[model samples]
Target: MHYVCLTTSDPFLSLRQVRIYREKATGQVYAIKKLKKLEMLLRGQVEHVKAERNLLAMVDNNCIDKLYCLFKDEEYLYLITEYLPGGDMMTLLIRKDTLTEDEASFYIGETVLAIKSIHKHNYIHRYIDVILII
Candidate 1:
């Protein structure tokens, strides 16, 4: 908490997100996701969570969202990543309803590159719905 200052937070995402922040020292913006440990445990997603964290730490590609750090207290796990003001592709798609061919190509090409990057690391991305625009 002392390392960063919390900025805007979405109440809608509060269930699984601590939301946006601005680093105290660098003034860099980041999105910090907070996952409830108890919910993860009850849903048997602990292994998946660990695997995700491990994969993020190992992977390094421009197309991939860099996981800067992760830490946990007794209740929650936090994932800090670069903030994209453009938000996720899923949300954008819903908001736009339709996109020009050029726009589609750009996003799709980026998404493909990101998935390919993950494949290069020997791990398939099971969730492709939340591709962030960066």
Candidate 2:
């Protein structure tokens, strides 16, 4: 795997953000969730991140963020994943209230398919919240 040191002011991620450079020269982007100090303080969150990584690694779904790589340093853990251009679903819904039936159906169907795929792999999405947008 190729690695490079990132500078401080990349707009792609906020402070303490971990990132994965695109494999090609097209200037694409992917998100790398970093282990936060607060999360380390909470045992549950730490365990959850581990479980999420383990589960994410086992499944393959377009709706789900793809876990491409993992890295660790003295202070933080990084999980590289595919970037979902359309942010979270709840955020979108909050911005626009009351979607048409067709739109709602489409999203719901997609969510169901994702859930089904996860289940087929013997994993459960315990936190099925609206915040998860493909």
lDDT top scorer: 1
TM-score of each: 0.82, 0.73
Provide the lowest-lDDT 10-residue window in model 1.
6-15
Report every candidate's CA lDDT.
0.73, 0.66
Model 2's number of clashes is 0
Model 1: per-residue lDDT, tens digit, 15-67?
47657878777778887878999988887888877877877788776655678
* Prediction 2 TM-score vs. true: 0.73
Q: Give the Cα-based TM-score of candidate 1 against the true structure.
A: 0.82
RMSD of each: 2.7, 4.8
Which pairs, if any, clash in model 1?
Answer: none
lDDT by residue for model 2 (7-116), tens: 22233323246454554455557676777646565645666666778877887777777787888887788888776656557666877777899888988888888888
